[model samples]
Structure formats: C-alpha cells, structure tokens
Target: MRVLLDHNIPHELRRLFPKDHDVYTAQFLGWEDYEDGELLNAAMDNNFAVLVTMDTSLPYQRNIDSFSLGVVVLDVHPATPDVLTSRMDRLVEACSRAASAREVVTLN
Candidate 1:
C-alpha cells in the first residue's frame, strides 16, 4: 500500500512501516501547510492508498466519505517514536486493508 503520513507524525516512523509498502509524508511531499481537504485530494490524486495522521479531529472535520483514500488516525497519548513504533503492526494492517473513502484507525 502507498501510505501518506501526516505532518504531525514523526518522519522517522516512515522507516518503521512495512518494507514492501510505499510510504510518504506531508513534509516529504512539500505540503505541510495544505488544508486537510486539499491534502486528501492530493493524496488520492497521487494514488496513495492510506493516510496516517495524529490529529484526532481530522475525521470529524473533513468529509472523508467524499474522497477515495483510507485514513489511520493515531490516537496515542504520547505520540513519541517509541510509542508509535509499538503499534506499527496494527497501523500497517489497517493501512493494508483500508480501502474505504474514510477509514480512521486509532493507534492508542
């Protein structure tokens, strides 16, 4: 799956994702300041299968069903690299199976 990590997530987490999948980040894409809707549109346009974000309100703020990309919203309390790393498997699984327009899987 091609996953796009949100700006809130640590860039290093990209390395923890499954080796077979293609993962990119908002920072890497030079879209760190783009609005959620625009970002989602860009992600879908690029054929990104999933979007990982730490923002809890993203699902509620945006009309996800309007798009065609899966989303994983990490809900951990302390979103450190170690904390996120522990749940990489779950995140990966969510990303792989997520095909809905809006899929928000919490990592807490």
Candidate 2:
C-alpha cells in the first residue's frame, strides 16, 4: 500500500512500516503547509492508498467518505517514536484493511 504520513506524524515513523508498503511524509511531498482537506485531496489525487495521521479532529473536520483514500488516525498521547512503534501492528493492520476501504480507522 502507498501510505502518506500526515505532517503531524513523525517522519521517523515511516521507517517502521512494512518494507512492501510505500510510505512518504507530507513534508517530503511538499505538502507540509497544506490544510487538512487539501492534503487529503492531494493524497487521493496521487493514488495514495492510505493516509496515516495524528490529527484527531480530521474525521470531524472533513467528510472522509467523500474521498477514495483510507484515513488512519493515530490517537496516541505524546506520539513519541517508541510509543508509535509499539503500535505498529495495529497501524499496519488498519492500513491493510483501509487500503480497500474509505473509512476512518482510529488507533489509540
């Protein structure tokens, strides 16, 4: 799956994804300044299968069903690398399921 990591997610987290999954950061895509909606749209336009983010309000702020891409919202506190790493299995599972779905999956 091609996953786009939202700006709020640490760039270092990309390295934790399964090797077969293509992961890119919003900053790497030149979308560091993009608003939530704009960033999601761009990810969809670029054929990103899923968007991993730490934005808790994104689901309420945007109509996720309107887009074709899947959204995985990481609801972790502090969001440190180790914390996120401990939840990689959940993240990967959500991303895998989301690759073919357009729903929002929240991982706490």
lDDT of 1 by residue, 2-107 (tens): 8899889899999987778898999999989999998999999999988989889998999887888888888997877888888888888877666543566666
For residue 106, model 1's alpha carbon misses the true position, in angstroms, by 2.4
Deviation from truth (RMSD, Å), model 1: 1.4
Give me the runs in candidate 1 sitting further than 4 Å from their true place: 100-102
lDDT per residue (tens digit) for residues 1-108 in model 2: 899999999999899998999999999989999998999899999999999998999999999999999999999997888999999999999998877777899999
Per-candidate TM-scores read 0.93, 0.97
Clashing pairs in 1: none
Counted clashes in each candidate structure: 0, 0
- Among these predictions, the greatest TM-score belongs to 2
Model 2 C-alpha lDDT versus the unseen true structure: 0.93
Each model's Cα RMSD = 1.4, 0.8
Off by over 4 Å in 2: none
